[model samples]
Target: MQSHARGHLVYAASGILAVHTERGTSIVPANRVAWTPAGFTHYHRAHGDTDIRIVFLAPSLARLIPDHPAVFLASDLAREVLLALTGPRNYDDTAPHYSRSARSRLLRVLVDELREAHEQPLHLPEPRDDRLQAIARMLYETPGDNTSLAELGKTIGASTRTLSRLFRDELGMNFYQWRTQLRVYHALVLLADGHDTTQTAYACGWANPSGFIAAFTNIIGTTPGRYRTSRQTTTSGRSAKSKV
Candidate 1:
């Protein structure tokens, strides 16, 4: 989306969301929310049948949030307030004064809840250098490619030392860290699409299921199997409700 004057909180009540911005990309599942500061050009892609919800914040409310894009764990209170504020028929200019007042109160509570929630490590920082961008793009396109950093540097005509420095300076992370994060991001998508852990591990470049599970759990706060199970449950619940 084009940059605009208002910052917003993007939450998915039912499924996962992937938000791309200048800084990098962030993956927000059911338990997380992504924030985009004012004037940030960004777009979102849903991983499943997502219930995308948006809460626009005015300048005063926006100032209480990060100046850059971020992702936070959505607490129970935050989720409730967000659902209330974004419910069907939430906004009505012709509505009664009490209705408007109730919405305002709900919005305030949502902001307060977000202010206290802990940020999630869901961001993948982008590198500014052209050479690094080439490398990143290649890996992003082929997450299963087990290419070494040195091998990638040769193809990109940059020394391993230079590439290492660029990754540290621009992204504040080592090559392996960034790659692992990318793999984890891909794993989330794969798992959400009903891929098993072993299949996802290989798809994301992990040599073995154990290694992939460890890395996935470390970054995502849950095992891939459990995450997949949760997604299954959510889908089933939605289906059951639809049949009713």
Candidate 2:
């Protein structure tokens, strides 16, 4: 757990990154960007061979964004700007140097782009209640567990009604909804590691690939197959470029 003096945006050019804080975890795939405000204790874990890019924002610009941790869909413009700001120019002296005014303009454009982009539902809020935490721990340990909430409640010595209420008040979602998010988070990690869609679906607790595809699409805005293919293509392209 660490905190930064300046707020920063993290983009995974390839692979996946999970940002964990007191609030919860935010899953950042290639199509998304994760923002962590200054002074928020957080840690990151990368899945597969990840290419991570980070751009720190000044206080003046950080105020334009949400104060809390969030995940946002990365538009094409946002992606390009992020890549430009954090790209190889930092280390390559032969590359053109951006003037201070030019860099500031780029930062403003990046902030504006983020302001217009939609906030993604990739954040999984942390559960404060002990029972809820227990349930979360169980699920996190085994996302494939198909146990009902009532049954899970029994193991934790809480009535189903009590657990349901806590789920609403504490987590802001029902058991199934939270579980689905958890499953999708796990599925992303699995996919990043090169697992097949069918195998990932089963590993993440989906009864069938179709159901997993629907839920994955609903949250991620892309099919698992397409996402994997894109990652593969990006990796191959990078490899070929490096060989040149």
Candidate 3:
């Protein structure tokens, strides 16, 4: 990130996404876009079959916008503007329709769209109780296998009936719902770290990409690619800058 610069936005038409940070992990969907601040060490994940676009802006331009990281509501017009900006012509002054003047005009409209769009954060609650938390961690760390509630119950040294009771008493939501949300959260992170949909879906205990995307859309409000694109970061693997 350039000094005085902030973060960028990723536009996703379809995909599953996740971001992991020092703060925690967040999973996002296609219907929403994310704004990550500059200097935040984060990674993103997405489905393999997605056509995603990433847009980076300097801090000067970003400052005129809100600072908090939030998801922007993607309207048809807004989505079109984003798609256009992703094109080389959109930012080229020489292009008749995408001249410098046109770029500036388009930029203003895009910024307004961002500021007014509905915002939502991709977050989920973990069990607060020590016992439940332990169980939750185990389930999350091993999502690949077909580990059932009964299996988890044994690991926790509690009967399945007792574990079910404990979940209701401590977390409010039932066991299956809790697990679903947890998987969704993990799926996001896996995708952001460069894991493809097949890998992430399977890791999240999903049988296939379709199954994963189905849940991702319902829970995150968008497909994985769109979610990952919204929070797209700069290409971190670029050649290192020459020292002064």
Report, for all candidates in order, the number of backbone clashes.
1, 0, 17
Best by TM-score: 2
RMSD of 3: 8.2
Name the 10 consecutive residues with the lowest summed lDDT in model 2.
235-244
lDDT of every predicted structure (CA atoms): 0.81, 0.87, 0.62
- How far is 185's C-alpha from truth in model 2 (Å)? 0.4
- Alpha-carbon runs more than 4 Å astray in model 3: 1-4, 64-66, 88-97, 124-137, 143-180, 185-218, 221-244
TM-score of each: 0.90, 0.93, 0.53
TM-score of 1: 0.90
The C-alpha local distance difference test score for the whole of candidate 3 amounts to 0.62
Ranking by lDDT: 2, 1, 3
Q: Could you give me the TM-score of model 3 versus the true structure?
A: 0.53
lDDT tens digits, residue span 42-92, model 1: 998888656677778879878987898999988888876765565533322
Question: Largest lDDT belongs to which candidate?
Answer: 2
State each model's C-alpha RMSD to the native: 4.3, 3.5, 8.2
- In candidate 1, which residue pairs get closer than 3 Å at backbone N, Cα or C atoms, i.e. clash? 1-42
Stretches > 4 Å off in candidate 1: 88-98, 236-244
Relative to the unseen true structure, what is the C-alpha lDDT of residue 153 in candidate 3, on a scale of 0 to 100?
A: 72
Q: Positional deviation of 153 in candidate 3, in angstroms?
A: 11
